[model samples]
Target: MTTIAPSRPLTAAGYPRGFKWGVSTSSYQIEGGHDADGRLPSIWDTRCRMQGKIANGDTGDVACDHYHRYPEDIALMKGLGLDVYRFSVAWPRVLPKGKGRVNQKGLDFYDRLIDGVLEAGIEPWLCLYHWDLPQALDDLGGWPARDSAGWFADYAALCCQRYGDRVKHWATFNEFAVFTLFGYCIDWSAPGITDREAHLKAIHHVNLAHGMGVDVIRDLVPGAVVGAVHNRQVVWPEKDTDADRRAAALLDAHWNKAFPDPQLLGHYPDLIAESIAPYVKAGDMAQICRRTDWFGLNHYGPIFAKDDPNATWGFHWGAAPDDADKSDIGWPIWPAAFRDELIGLTKTYKLPIYVTENGMGGNDKVDDKGEVNDATRIRYLTLYTDAMKEAIAAGADVRGYYVWSLLDNFEWGTGYQNRFGLVHVDYETQKRTAKASYAWYRDYIKAARAAE
Candidate 1:
């Protein structure tokens, strides 16, 4: 039922009954048991080893020590009154070498984490992949290899069979385009390579893997509410010049349409179809297009693209206008874009939508008073949530909202320089202090759920 009038501005956060509120965290970003208990290194671990790839010489080596302190983290989730907790299973942790040798201790760790989340009265949403591919898998050609799809399906089968009884919400992958585009087309992320053909192959292969993973989840896990998470946002031209405009259009295809259009609508985006044609076989779309329960969107803000003849695909990341309000990390803060993306996504994809990740990143530090008062993060959350409520009023099927992170852990590339969590973590002592945004989110959840 409609909770607010369509013509009015969003005043109060009165979402539909049963609206879900939660938080998200990834394995490599937070869980720091790298090399403990038969667990092997992921591509991210290898990336950290390279001399200059990570900032401040920071690594996730002991990040938040969430691997050992998940019980404490689960208490934080309970303290927030979360209805759900979204987390990913590190591939290397489960299959130390990507496949063949199953790590029992690795499996057991997730068992305890899942059980703890359940005991805290929160449902578990387990994402199978969150860009931490096993370094061994990268050695075997990573997502560019067609066989990688089979590897992912086997891994999904392992997870589904083990945890399907308790966990019903399964995401095949989180933000396919981000890792593929950044890793292959740019040197921003791991397994960094810059080749057009490699980028195309990675895109097609990852989409194939997602499709195969979905089928495996359905086959192995009964009552699975399966979906694939895509990082979607508006792509704008960096300048008014024709070159930048063309670059932005091409980037829009790669960033927004490449993954979801094929998986959901059964065809590749026009700009990408011809380039990816050489790799696609007959009926491959049918194989990749599996039935999913929801569209998981991880949106932050609009991206601008500039023409760069020397870059892979001849397009590069640009910046927001100088006057634009930005997060402390320089990410643009435009709630209208978030609102429009939601409304547009509902019309285009026609699936129940869950905002799997949305939050601000800051250079947060605990004050001398032993407290973190991140007032800027509170504003970002307030503006974004109000935009979301506006989207719901405009006929969007948005169901749940989970912030980007639950703790200030290791951010990739930027490393520990960026903090995107509501709860501030003192990386030195492993102390978890709830920030001002944490209290804001907790009360926001309470108020959103209590709305009539």
Candidate 2:
């Protein structure tokens, strides 16, 4: 056991009064029932069906089975005393065909979900898209086509009409940067396509969709808490050399700043234009620069870069983080990098920020005592929370912190291999076990609530 040491108690006073504390999860990642209740095929549904992509040949076909077990999941959140619950609405469920006629069964699932969340005394922060675009939509060109923006807006309107009354916190999209880069650029995620032109086009359409979703929510729920959830990376150079600096700048522009620059700054970074102009079109920039209420930042590890003479556009490979530890996913657990990323955003955008997604993944296992006390995960949370406090002290207007997930479930391409949850899931039995980190977070919540 990693012993807990005596230290100054972390307090909410480190953040603004009424700062939100919550946990986040996505539908496809947790809500299994992939084929139940008229939930049609999403890109994830189709992708997981493709062999050799996901580990263990895992499909979300029965992921934590949250679809049939959400009441218990709500109880988990309630027990943790979380103030907010961030989750995504599976697009295919809302619009089975991705456009046109609505799927009442799909909408009804969210209706019950929102109601259940409200009854548990936790606010629902809904992400209109979590990259599980309906396979039907992908058949029609997916996010790369202009029509996707309109299709997403229509889906947004349907959701707003149904559950906008109780669910005030609305996130238009979650991590467009990851979707575009991983899905298209890297071809590692669902609906995978490896064309730079397709990637840039998809990125712009998602931005436009976010703006459109914001409009729909604002119109439906005038006092709605609407925002866009972007995964912001911290890009640092391996050295102070001019080449390294330029490489880091390119990485930052594309990975760290691309999504928010247009929405908040009213223009893509000049560097973004230069890097991606071959794929972008006239007037596309203007449409992507639409406004939003607040910015949701999902930060994890930092990247180190150095110039390469042989890479495309003078861009080069980024260094792996040097944090003492890495997650089961091989992602570095450098909490300070997260803090720095937030501070950088605050300085650049001057907007109210929410740490929308943060967590550590581990292959949690039960010990001889029939308990899964994950010391490493607890340490990750403590260090990360301390870093968040540091960011607040540095004058970042971070108003909330939502851990990446509440329970272990499907992890896209990695499937159920990497667990980034406070609660552990017994995939076979569909059982939920609160790991040591869960109790630690519960205690942290108690501390935060008492701090006020």
Candidate 3:
């Protein structure tokens, strides 16, 4: 593990005043009471049952058991000195059948969770969707269906009426491309299907859903901060040739700009607009473009693109250098690109930004002393966060930064193999052990507050 000392103190003086610092988690990733309290099956639940769908056959059926241990988790956040905690609400939990009938018990769970978050002096940043679509909705054709916009709008309106009074900050969706493209185009995620047309249609519907969600929240919750979290990659071409550059631009249009351009700018990038034109309705763009208060960006590292005429998307991922520093999941660590992405998004969107997710996953283990010494994760956080500070100094209006996770939880297709949390979790016993990175973050937050 490479440890680099901070050139200056890790204090609020290094960042803008009133900057928010926090951690993030999703419902299906951390909240494991899968069958508890009248919750119905989500698409992920169905996908987990399929043979060979998840790594090592591991499922989120009992992941971290956060549903039962949120009090302990909130205490952990309070101890970490977090100003906010960003989390997602499972739609299937509240609306078991996806459309009608409210589950009071499910609503009660989040009611208590938000109350607990406030009781602990941490603001709850709630996200409506985090890829755990209701299986009932999937049965009715899911995002590929044009009616998904109405389904999601109804869900959003219900949530706003139920919990929006207490929760002021809300995000409509998380990583539009990951769920739509990976789920529909590549068959890597839930409701796995391999159809380019479905992928394109899913893109339009999800964007429309986001816009409708914004409208619903505005109408239902007064003074609510509404936005969506997008995972934007700083794409680079494998070679500096015209063809490779064009391929990188095309990949950017599909992967990065497809969702945000429509939401923020009210139109798709010209490269893929015609490809997606067939599914778009007359007033879809009007609904897809809403007044988002902030842009939630989830970035990890840069993606290298290469020209591939034979590829389905006219581009293919190029391999990183063998010697490049990487996380346990083999994602290359490029802090410079992280800084670039922050600045680029700020320049393009011109909205106050929140880095909603950024962290490196590692194969962390508790040593014989019953302590986890994840120096690699600590280093990654320090470098990337410092990069974010640099981006802010370079004129990016970044308002907040949240680590990718709060606990070691089920990592989607990778299952529980990747640990990205400052707090380590023992899967068998459900023990929460704070790693060395946890202490580092605590002290950093303390210093930042003191400096402020």
- True-vs-predicted CA distance for residue 148, candidate 2, Å: 0.9
lDDT of 3 by residue, 1-452 (tens): 11222222334467767788899999999999999999999999999999999999998889999999999999999999999999999999999989999999999999999999999999999999999999999999999998999999999999999888899999999999889978887668999997888889899999999999999999999999999999999788888899989989988898899999999998999999999999887898998999999999999998888988776677878767778888878999999888888778877898889999999899999999999999999999989988887877677778888998899999999999999999999999999999999999889887877887
Q: RMSD for each model, in Å, please?
A: 2.4, 4.6, 3.8
Rank order by TM-score, top first? 1, 3, 2
**Higher-scoring candidate on TM-score, 1 or 2:** 1
Model 3 has an lDDT value of 0.90
Q: What lDDT would each prediction earn against the true structure?
A: 0.91, 0.81, 0.90
Best by lDDT: 1
Candidate with better lDDT, 1 vs 2 = 1
Tell me the lDDT of model 1 at 177. 91
TM-score of 3: 0.95
Worst 10 residues of 1 by lDDT: 1-10
Off by over 4 Å in 1: 1-12
Writing each residue's lDDT as its tens digit, candidate 1 over 1-452 gives 23322332332565766778899999999999898899899999999999999999899888989999999999999999999999999999989999998999999999999999999999999999999999999999999999999999999999999999999999999999999999999999999988889899999999999999999989988899999888999999989999999999999999999999999999999988999999999889999999999999999999999999998788999888999999999999999999999888888898889999999999898899988999999999989988987788887778899998899999999999899998988888989999999999899888776664
The better candidate by TM-score, 1 or 3, is 1
